[model samples]
Target chain A: MANTEQVKLLGFWASPFARRVEWALKLKGVDYEYIEEDIFNKSSLLMELNPVHKKVPVLVHGRKVIAESFVILEFIDETWKQCPLMPQDPYERAKTRFWAKFAEEKILDGAWIAMCSLGEEKEKAIKLAVEAIEKIEGELKGKHFFGGENIGYLDIAMGWMSYWLPVWEEVGSMKIVNPLQFPATTSWMNKFLDHPVIKENLPPRDKMIIYFQNRSTELASRPHDWFRT
Target chain B: MANTEQVKLLGFWASPFARRVEWALKLKGVDYEYIEEDIFNKSSLLMELNPVHKKVPVLVHGRKVIAESFVILEFIDETWKQCPLMPQDPYERAKTRFWAKFAEEKILDGAWIAMCSLGEEKEKAIKLAVEAIEKIEGELKGKHFFGGENIGYLDIAMGWMSYWLPVWEEVGSMKIVNPLQFPATTSWMNKFLDHPVIKENLPPRDKMIIYFQNRSTELASRPHDWFRT
Candidate 1:
């Protein structure tokens, strides 16, 4: 069943948040116009669409606009229920959402700080980031995906591990996601990347490294400015 | 219409996160046993129930346990369909979640810091907190509640403003939510307090002042320890 509704996504190429939404849209086989956003020098359309956060990924479905990636993902799932993102069971759904929140609030922030800082600050960040990774590993519990058999909300929310974590690890010169340590998460990362939709959507690893390396250099000089970006 | 499942809430009396969940239970008229935990000296049950965060406001429904107040609110809304906390429309639900998240990530932390710190740091915290309040005021837009007609998820998430903001203001010696500056928020605050469930749930103002005063004193001495508690 082809969707006739006009769907557009304003996103930056490197944003893990944007990538999560892209994966969801693709998995559901929904066609959308993807607009590349310059996050550093944001577009007027981006500003007009998401005046509150003024950030991507912003989803515009016809006249209605939605900001925040998790919100956008839920909106997409609800609007196009062809491939359900959230579980039907309320308890299971709540568990999925809890981990999704954890990915955003706890995991991403720590990874960002770890990748950006240097010296003792960097060491502290690494410890915190690893602790978060261990928590994710605990959640995995030998499951193929966070959603058991298929990729779901928690899987999409944690999509960053496959692409971004590697770069962050390389840039920070740290190893938080090794198969030796977190076997379940490491395996999940591989499986997540191997998924056709996710595989196709992710940017090249070599390119990501270069981009992150340059970004990391800038962040190292201004470590305290982690929250601004 | 009675719930036969065993429902219990592990919470701290002073925590706003815990309060939000408590209010949701009260509003839903769900019979639940409220267990006040000593957060400073973690209860074994609290640690076991919420091994990841080991934090307050853990909701136990039958055999299932849910942590994080926002997650619990969603769970409660889903489990008990009557007197729904979230909007039925997906867009509206997303908007509610967005603001709820903003309240947690931006508003509460700023308020905590502002009320805790002294001198220059306090001024900066106050600025950030006021900015967040101004944003909420914009969202209010002449509404009685964040949910427009009813006290919904966003309202519950921001319930802290009604109880905690005044205490914080008194401790910080700053006025962020006055009728002159944030008329809409000020009005909403009053309306929130007037709600029977909310009115009944909140702690005594005098006791709150004493608790917050002691907290502020401790935070002032160890400004960097803000995130720990």
Candidate 2:
């Protein structure tokens, strides 16, 4: 079920969420026009396509627009049905989605919170982030990846950890996820980063580090008095 | 594709999340055992099945265990393939999942915060909750349900609003949502509640109200200084 419909992805350069969609497209051999969005000054096209969230990683499939990275990944898989991102079995699919959702709701979210705080709050955030990382590390034990041998939904969902996490650790000067503490996760991360398609698509590492360094400084200046939801 | 595997749902009677799984099962007419859990003191079965969240509702299909209402709903739809909860088209399915996610992350989460707060912060939370409701109301315009004429994935995801929300509103003495502000949502709520499957399976209204009232009071007494995330 190959689609000839023009598929375009609106993305920000340093966004790992956007990378998930890009990797899925490349893996499925789907050709899509990629338009990079200026984060500071978002394009009218991006705003128009995703009015609700107004965030990027929006997939324009023919006349239809789909926002949200996970949603786009699912759409890509369903539309292409080749180099399948999800497992064939229902139980396996559910488990894959569950972990992917955990990646979104916990691991990624916790790291973000940790980045946007200072002092005691930042310490607490880092602690929680480590806990989430440890939980995921346990889940990855003895498996090549979260979904077994090949990179799949859970791997794509947690892809950010492969590249962006080091930047986060360097910028914040905190051990968000150490290879020693999370050996399984470290192995999986290296494996994900080394994948041919993923390796080719990732943005330059130096640029990502600088961007997050600036972001961390900006967040540190803000009043750190809010509780985690 | 029906199997003879024993299906059992571990749920707290007053939980709207649990009700989502129950509704899906009933809608599909898949006979399963219902075990009402004591939420305060969870059962070993519930803990063993869903060690990750340790929350209801957990679906046990023979030896397989699945947790999280939205994830379980997707599983049920896939396994049964009867009374489809999701749309057939991939684009439509993505849209449905998008809104269902919005319902979980915003509407339900926002309302929970509002009910758990007091004074000015509570007022702010209520305002945000209403905004989320209004957004959904806009989405619901001219459709009987979020998925159009049929009750689908988005409807089940947002089903908590139809029943649990009213109790929250009344207990909190807040007009967070009403027909004047959310005419479409109100109508949809009535339609959903009137459906035989939903109506028959819903816990007693008085019981729900009391449970929520107690819950709201308990939450209000707790420290209320959390970020919205």
Candidate 3:
């Protein structure tokens, strides 16, 4: 089965989205070659595969090119039958999808929050992050996973939070998730980190902190003048 | 089965997204109650069904609520079972999904392009609108519909190009689709607009123009003074 299929992953080490594709492929026991992308000088082929978004974690198999991290997640689940990332029941699948989207729209939507924004911009970003995290905490009630009892699709979609977000919060010098406020979620976070498949695949925490700190500095020093070629 | 199950559609009158839901229902011969939304004063139930996005074109059938216009179109086809929207072949299905997603992402991503943007902003918006249209035009290639000969899932998803975008272009004072540049798509536009189901159910074009114009005005006049609100 592996011999006939040519699977390749194009990614950068520091990207949380790239980490998602890596985790899913590993869980599914799919074998593929990894090609690292320079975070700053992204390759031309990467641009070709994803012309519209032109961003990576692009998964290419045989002649098929799939972009958009969320869409790529779905395609992997569909194309590879071995490890089912989503549930069999369509309703549960819908619910899982809803949370995956909620997690994305909430957490990552505020990535710009703690960036170069200062004072009031910084303040609004913090409030938005707090509100988003509070909403997530509410969704975590009575569930070990976003899909009750076991880690599921939403888990893979939100794999970054247990690791990367803490790093970002540290760099920004603002706390988004509080254990006291999100006790259930905090416990769930520990379980997510403890899972065998995820735990083995997790990135080095110290390295991520250094990466984001450098990124924050670069963002802060961006020129005030805007130009288009 | 259709009579036994209650299907209701929640939408806004002037929205192209709402039109997609209407076309899908009519194609499937699934009778549904259409509830119009005041975009400014969205109802509480609409809020509950779509708590995350809090935006409409929601499909409620029996006890299930589906948001995201693309997902709802697929659900309507599956739930009704009278008319099929997606192609049987997986590759063809993937292509259809890609085009549908392309139309949606570009249009939705460019939502803020229409606001308080003049001179360079208008040029930027037109460039964006043209790029989006050209991609859709490129995909038309040798197919009658975005999904080939039959009007299927992707076409319903791209339904906006025929009815809604013209309204938007009129109100925004810009021309998006260049028929001369895209002959295949130009012909499809005529067929799609003339389809009885689409033609009969569309909100009058002049009314939609007025609706969006007023909304645009309201958004423009708001004091974006960055007042630390």
Candidate 4:
């Protein structure tokens, strides 16, 4: 059986959102042409493809274009039924979706604020980030992964935090996820990053550090643009 | 052929998020016990059910508890396969999810800011709200509903806007979705609200206006509390 659907992805190298889609596609054993976009000077094609957000991690399957990383991940899972990223049972799927949304809203967003902001806001964000991490620690109590024994939907969704959070902490000279405080989350992070599919696909850590260092310096001068990054 | 599983929904009357769940349940012909929660004086059950956010629109099915309207909607659709809220095709489902996310992040959030804020912020939010609505108007160019003919996932997700936006406008004494500017959106709003399930489930208009009026007054007094509501 020869499948001939032209699958393409527009992504930024440092964007966790883009990386999630890339990982999902890779995990499903689906071949895709990846286009790295310059976040500073976004391409016209990127804008045309995702007019609403004009953000990266846009998936184009033949003529159908899908933007937003979560949406794209689900699309990949459904389009290629080989390795299921989502669970089969409805209840399990819902729980997975709930935690994934939490990762984005609480953990990721809080980490961004902690990294990008200054003084009171930074301290507040750090506290919130630690709280979110602790909650996830409880979720990973006995399970090896968020999706028990396998790196399923939630593991992929939250995998970027393992690499990026460390980079963010270094760039900010702050500690949010203390190993002693969040041992379970720390263990899960180690397990998730150790996975071949995830380990191979992540942006280079050294490069990410340099990138964030530059971004942090840039954001310091322009506080208003902290969130845009 | 009977559903014996215990189903319950904890919701708030004025919340668009809660209304979305109610509409979804009615569309699927699912019978469930509805418990209204007081947002001011928090209930123990609401807090226990949704320990993280402690927000309304928590769906308890047997032993499983699901929070967040979008997550609950997906659960409802998957659990009861009768009137399918999501499209059968992967591509179409992806698009619907994208728009539903857009509705929450852009339209709903923008509308909140427009109604809650004062002076410059309100004006800026109003501009953004119009832009989001105009985008949706373009999406509804030739379609009767966001789902086309039938009110599907997106229509249910964004349906609250048809009723609540008008109430916000009346309370604020400002017009965001002018009939002249967004004809297609205006038409779709009418069609959506006219749907029997939607019409029957929505909170009373006059009561909503009074509620928003009081809320706007309170928000005006305490500017910091604007976004939380």
User: Order of candidates by DockQ, top first?
Assistant: 4, 2, 1, 3
- List the global CA lDDT of all models: 0.85, 0.82, 0.73, 0.86
Question: For model 3, how does the per-residue alpha-carbon lDDT over B1-229 read when each residue is reduced to its tens digit?
Answer: 4336788888887777777889999987877898888767879988898886778888888788888777677666656667688886544566676667777656543533543345666677667767787777777877787766668898788776787666666777776667788787778888888878888888887887787677666556441211110
Report RMSD (Å) for each prediction in the order shown: 2.1, 2.9, 3.9, 1.9
Model 4 segments more than 4 A misplaced: A1-3, A221-229, B221-229
lDDT string, candidate 3, A80-184, tens digits: 877688887655566666677767766765644555456766777667767877877887888888757766678888878787778878888887778998897
For model 3, what is the C-alpha lDDT against the true structure? Answer: 0.73
Model 1 scores what on Cα lDDT?
A: 0.85
Please report, as a residue range, the 10-residue window in candidate 2 chain B with the lowest summed lDDT.
Answer: B220-229
DockQ, 0 to 1 scale, candidate 2: 0.82
**Candidate 1 C-alpha lDDT tens digits along A1-229:** 2247699999888888888889999999988899999888988998899887788889888788988888889888988998798999889999998988777756777778778887788788778778888888888977999888999988999889888888888987887677898888989999999998889888888888888888888877775565322
Candidate 1 chain B has its poorest 10 consecutive residues by lDDT at: B220-229
Model 3, C-alpha of A69: deviation from truth (Å): 1.0
Clashing pairs in 1: none
Fill in the DockQ of model 4.
0.91
- How would you order the candidates by TM-score, starting with the best? 4, 1, 2, 3
Scored against the native two-chain complex, candidate 1 gets a DockQ of 0.82
Candidate 4 structure quality by residue, lDDT tens digits, A65-129: 99988898888888888878899988899999999999887888788777877898889988988
Candidate 4 pairs with clashing backbones? none
Summarize candidate 2's per-residue lDDT along B94-211 as a digit string, tens digits.
9998888877777777777788778987788788777777778888899988777778888888887878888878877887777987899999999998888888878888987787
